[model samples]
Target: MNDTYKMMIVDDEFEIREGLNSFYWERFQFQVVGLAANGKQALDLMQRSDVDIVLTDIKMPIMDGIELSRAISVHYPHVKIVILSGYKEFSYARDALQAGVSEYLLKPVDLKHLGESMMKLKHLLDTERQSSQKLQSYENQLANSLPAARDHFFQSLLEDLLPEYHEAKEKMSLLEIEMNATYYCCAAVKIQWRDQPDGSLTDANKLAKATTIIERHLEASQCHSYTLKRKAGELAIFLNLNATTVSPRKSLSLLFDHIIVAIEGELGGRSIIGLGEVYQSLLSFPDSYKQARSIMERHIFRERSGLFQWDPADSLHMERKEYPYSVETKLLDAVLEGNSGNSTMYFQHFWDSCGLDSEHAELPLVLRYLTPLFTMLERRLDLHGASFETMANLHMPFTEYVEQFQTLSQLKIALDRLISDITLHIRKLNDVVQTTSHSAVQQVKKYIEEHSSEKITLNQMADLVYLNPSYFSIQFKKETGINFIDYLKYCRMEKAKELLRRIDLKVYEIGELVGYQDRKYFATTFKSYTKLTPLEYRQSFITY
Candidate 1:
């Protein structure tokens, strides 16, 4: 609460003004900062002073309390008004109340009543100030989180997660992304260090610096651009071009030329940019991104650092060949069924189906064919609550997996090993499901109860119970008549309710104890679960 509130005294009579000013306003945690004879003078004084409350007489010369109150209500709605008047007319009090007067006291004001009114106004001011502070804190937090949120939105957009135009438009507006262009283009930029290692601070600093340089150049260009860090040493730049532009392709090419030159000449590092064609609708952004990524992947064969634009004619050879989807499906089924031998056989069959020989498939045609296959396998693992990290000890960005092998035979061997590892992991999971099917669900429930305050994931729980995520989900639901996600939410909400009983714990601190890192999200979830916000719930428990 604020220690002192500044107040103004407005009255035509000098005696009334002086007497009120002489009183011990400090006792009520207020200070009389100004004295005005009328409403006009009061308004003038208010402009010069920071007044929190205004005590004015109803009938005064030039301007009156009602007019002053209305003016304050219009210009300074936060300022509390107390009316002191000799007139006892019901109309005077009615007009005063309508004009936003906080309290109306007659001619001979009671000292006790005045003191009480001051206390009440002070409490209201304090509460409003606290609410304002909380709102400002939330705004600051939202501001800090906007960058990460924007990155996530762009990633989802590139992945074609927001399928509907309206949904994508809503998200873009929420993220403050202003992509108001008739044409859209995507470019994938990969930064390779000439000397430094991948994960060093120098790598990050250089990448950030390179991004800054690129942004500066883009800002100077005619088109609108947005840059997102796709992965380590990789950036995705989305361009919004005007329909009136003569040659969007040539414009983007020239921009990339400057960007590449700046990185290579200034940072002594190599940069490869893959430019995609412009599209009319934002829904086609994923197609543009795919094209750009496809061009970027070709860098593995060329081993060059420069700008590469997508050419429709260049892909004709690969487009004519039939993709071995049947072999891929067989391999995926074998892995999921935990048959390592069949998985290996199917994987080899898939490789041979690609029409590859013992010599390295260094051609871009073979890469274009194999890349989508590996991407599909990765996606399949993800769907089954598995990852390349756990199964094959491989980190993401899939390109790293391909770069590990120099020849087609080596890639085949590595992929076979991955298939073997995945099948073995799945076999173990199936064995556990057979042995402790019922107790595994109980074990997961107990784990959730004990570890609700920690980060828990369905995949982690599935791994713990040694069952496939899909199977674990079905079994857990059958045992408890509730899904794993709901059960986890129930445990967390129950814990939050219990913590809200403690007067010492702040709402955010309670949220943290209940495993919600974001305070706003916690409050929202809490209100949705319990029909009360964290603060409201706590207040309900208090004994007045």
Candidate 2:
């Protein structure tokens, strides 16, 4: 792919132009984008398209090869030019060569020699393009970010602790971050140093160097990004999906790989990156950020290295923490079944079974059981509209109330209230998910209708609603009474049936318009759904 270069052939003689074009350009890793009869035509085409190399005859009616070569040399200097001359005039050859033409071929150009020159020119172009892209990437990164401002804003953004979203927007504007991206995700690199307590000066110097290398690598990443030094002592890069409007998640892995490869090869820094989930809204970025941080915290505790992506499992790392699972499971089953009558009874039983006996209760140990358990139950409840920041805020109240409870009775009361508060939040979120998920599913149905001409996938629609793809797949089926893929195919078939109503559209054309590139596959799908081939379906409709 890198070896491929675009070229143009220009000459007054059709034979010469046709002859050059006849020789397989693709064989030499070249593509002929244009063929011009005169120098003026060639120059015009060169100006319009990216013609990397131009092969032209020395004599032409409109503009002589010498004049065209000189004009190209002055204006489109990056373009390589090869002069072809039937005239034995050494002066014409010398003049063309002086105009910075790459090569001077005789009247009957040798394909062998031309191929060799093209191979060399192709290598040069590839090298130059890579260098230019790197330089541009570095310049763009430098121009967009400042240490203090970027850090403060992103730290506040990802921690999801910003006081006001409007303030965040203002800060982002001030930082020149375009808020036009469809989705965003955070990548956090947690630096874990060796046991050796190096000198402060030495550590600082290496840190600065590592950061510089990181920024250099980040610049090469083909996505809009912002960097920050997090309070957790990690370098955070917020990635904005720019190339496509589909989803950041689709390209995230590739970009993450780019970051990992660059740092490993260049920085030699001891770090593991935590890849956060994709977020749609600005407020949600903090939750995603927290997710990244939480994953990084796992890296610290597990004493593991490399890139670890955020998963719900990270929050449940205390697998060995003993708790009354039977009672907990009974409580969960009651809640999920919406047996509100038995739910509280089951929850109380679980609390009692924890061996806390109120008086001997260690608050910290109690929370370790409660925290992940609450999250586990909440997942089953399908909670939404709550950020991790809000959950973290629970820590202060939880700790304060624990201090206020001096007796077993007081501790039990506090525990009941806490449980009640958590359950209430869960129920409220469940109600919201029930109502909103229906509307969101409908919204996806409508979106599929609108984007019938383009590719539509379950993951793309899941990203649209910010739901886990598997969960959304299930919910979509439960709500609409059709599996997502089947629903999409049905939608496409419906659109195809409508398109078939048009006398101007052929069956194959209708297939393409309805997001099916393979006509045979479309026909099979259409027949499977509607019990008729596309033509038969159209004819049946025409009978109406």
Winner by lDDT: 1
lDDT of each: 0.78, 0.67
Cα deviation of 68, candidate 1, in Å = 1.9
| Candidate 1 lDDT by residue in tens digits, 442-475 | 8998998897766677668889988766557656
Tell me the spans in candidate 1 whose CA falls farther than 4 Å from its real position: 13-15, 45-49, 160-162, 192-201, 217-224, 257-269, 297-306, 317-544
Question: How close is every model to the real structure, measured as TM-score?
Answer: 0.53, 0.31
Where does model 2 exceed 4 Å of error? 1-147, 163-167, 193-201, 231-233, 243-247, 301-304, 313-544
Local accuracy of candidate 2 as per-residue lDDT tens digits, 121-222: 777778888986775576446444545666777776664454333234434533435444566778777765544454443555556665776666555654
Report the Cα lDDT for candidate 2.
0.67
Per model, how many backbone clashes are there? Answer: 0, 0
Which ten-residue region of model 1 has the weakest summed lDDT? 162-171
Highest TM-score model number? 1
